[model samples]
Target: MLDLDDTLFHESDFARSGFAAVGAHLENRLGVSDFASHCERLLKAGSRGRIFDQALAECGHHPTPDLIEELVDIYRSHKPSIQLPRDTVAFLEHVAGLPTALISDGPARMQRNKVVSLGLDKLIDKIVLTGEWPDGYGKPHPRAYGEVMQWSGRIGSDHVYIADNGSKDFIAPRALGWKTVQILRPGRVHDGVAPTAEHEAEFRIASLDEISLRRVLAGSR
Candidate 1:
């Protein structure tokens, strides 16, 4: 189980929630109208150290470790209305008998808040956070899957990873021999990269509750 944002929770009026907080913080400090652009670049560049230093230099503020840490703290403090999704809970309850895992990439505390909020800690068999170990990297990287495989004591082919993001998360897992369930949530899109003719999945599901392990692992396709 990979969390999309808050996993079971959806922030009400999510569009305007914490975006402005970060934007305002960056705009004031960086003197850039588009702080989000810089932030995106920072993250996409694998949190490049020098880019952040340059950002600080541009702001006439020397880069300090504390400043960056504070920036992350302020960002995390930006609250979103987290309302647990009933469907997610129902899915977790239904799949209680099967081995399950929650793999996510984010700060330990913040992600832990989300997991606890959803009571997922009690439900999942394993909780794998890439950030907790040296093998930390975002999805589409096999390392995250490797950690999950380690915890579950299962080979990649034995697990079915259901995720909403097709390219970033599902693609590598599919290639690594895990079955994929593409969740069609709003705002999630295929990037016009069609699945290869040779790429076949055991199943595709809209929600976690819709899949049964028997059907998924039985060579049902």
Candidate 2:
């Protein structure tokens, strides 16, 4: 299995794409210029959860809840301009014969758009967007991982999950006895380190280029 976002592609790329889309919407509807740049600046400065509001403020606009909500909708629903890295494409090809699955967490529509934009439906056998589940069923919950097991009829070390986001990505899979590998792609959003050992992946590599089916299967055994 695999994770989306920074695992297959840079999350920042998606952010920039969404920002541009939202910025274009603002320019068309509210006459705001450079909104995307303002959002990118705020993100680089470590701002989270309120980039839109802060960016609007920086653009000299009094951002109201309604306006912020509208901008967020635009950001999430826009067609993302994102693609898998060359190495990621190679890695997928190397594992083409394996039963591959993608498990991701986020708004369903946004994540679905990303999958389509990345053309993953043609590459992966199963794609699980955890957001489609009821609340509290996202990563670290084991629901998605268990679903993968059921789908592939594999259990324990028979399953290997490759993902970023060490904070929560490994928790459920690790507990389920699945081998986990954390890929620390350059420019990835996650720190690739968990707050505790229990949350960290069993193995870590700097890139997907380092991975191979033989190596992971042997290590899992």
TM-scores for every predicted model:
0.62, 0.96
Q: What count of clashes does model 2 give?
A: 0
lDDT, each prediction: 0.60, 0.90
Candidate number of the best lDDT: 2
In angstroms, the error of model 2 at 68 is 0.6
Lowest lDDT 10-mer window, candidate 1? 185-194
Off by over 4 Å in 2: none
**Candidate 1 deviates by what RMSD?**
6.6
Query: Model 1, which residues run further than 4 Å from truth?
Result: 6-72, 78-80, 134-136, 187-202
- lDDT value for model 2: 0.90
